[model samples]
Target: MVGRADDAVWRPYEDGGSLGWMGTQGGTIARDEDFGGLARLTYELDDSRSFHALSCSVTGWLLYHRFFDNAAAASAAFEEMKPALEALLTQLPEGGPSVPGNARLGGPILAAFTVRYG
Candidate 1:
């Protein structure tokens, strides 16, 4: 899962990685709850919920980037779910990244998303 998440971020394809193919796997949850994970903001700002924005950004990236792979399918998925996530992002307030106690993990991890599409 960590590798998959990393691939989704860095997209180090030369290293045998991918941003992964995001599609409706199966079941309602996959489309609903499971995919919800993709939209959960991976960041936080002093308990302010950066993860919500991160989720929207990542899901949007997946929807837009992978559209060519299956245009109709991708569009359908995006239509079924992009609005609410977008609304969540709009509601989020910006703040400085919350630092944790440990030096290594002190900085924000999922506070923001870096997306790439080819």
Candidate 2:
């Protein structure tokens, strides 16, 4: 699915936000009224060399928190990203395009962690 999305140039963050655009595609800015007031967005590099950049970034934060006695906060952060993670899991399965990283398991872990800790 991720490969298909990549092929189709599917972008989760068409609008400028906390999330950065990935892959070979050019960057674009979009607006979501629902998130307009609450979110502050910043972008550095538009394309991510690794296919699982977002997943790795979030997981890296979680891991850091886990090692820093901030697991609770990390769990909370995962809760916020749970929806997209789950969606990614549902959209991609084993041997699927999104199997680029630990996303296959990360998605389920995010979902379970959200339910358990959130």
Candidate 3:
């Protein structure tokens, strides 16, 4: 259910290491799918195509941002996916949030994922 397209960028957590983990590996943009409601170009740690994303608060904050190996695709993908991803957030469950071990949603959610070469 998870793979890559022909286009993906390869940017790391470099150019300006933030904290201890800044220089560490960023992550693979398995898909341009959306899982969480991160506004700053973020995605779930796993299962971008599903609501079964598992991550603690800390990990969730580090959601991956998908990029493209090509500039044209990059802009297009970002533009197209941003609104779609943001809209998903508005459809979250009415309750507070999922428990310790549960899918983010009670049903399946259609999401798009983007990724880089890394």
Candidate 4:
């Protein structure tokens, strides 16, 4: 199930556990877990070197994760994708913010920490 987010590329795991990067986030890697068979994982391209994960419910509009990177590279990536981001924002619902304002964009660093801490 390969898909594109602007210029980045992603795909689902062989077991259908998680959707991950194909060649965009450095290389091929899959993040797997029991997604209750109802998870929708979306990768938003932040730049040429980075991206964010927007994990949501397949049956509802509930957003589970909004991972972001705060590195200089990520900042530059965000700037590069600002216009697209704005366009995305315009497509949001009218009532309120669809995503949390301070969700952490899990990346390599955060993944390492998660493995080590939990």
Question: What TM-score, computed on C-alpha atoms, does each candidate reach?
Answer: 0.23, 0.21, 0.37, 0.25
Report per-prediction Cα RMSD to one decimal: 15.1, 14.9, 12.9, 15.4
Error of 4 at 82 (Å): 28
Give the per-residue lDDT of model 3 (tens digit) for 26-118. 433322322232333322222232221111111121244343444455545555655544454444343324443224452343223222212
Which one wins by TM-score: 2 or 3? 3
Q: Candidate 4: deviation at residue 74, Å?
A: 12
Off by over 4 Å in 1: 1-68, 96-118
Please write out the lDDT profile of model 1 over residues 33-87, one tens digit for every residue: 2223344322111122211112224332222222223335434544544554444
Worst 10 residues of 3 by lDDT: 52-61
Ranking by TM-score: 3, 4, 1, 2
Highest lDDT model number: 4
The local distance difference test score of each candidate is 0.29, 0.32, 0.32, 0.35
* Cα RMSD, model 4: 15.4
For residues 1-118, write the lDDT of model 4, one tens digit per residue: 1111353322343465334455233422334322323333444444445554433222222333344553454334334333433333333333333335312322342344334323
RMSD of 3: 12.9
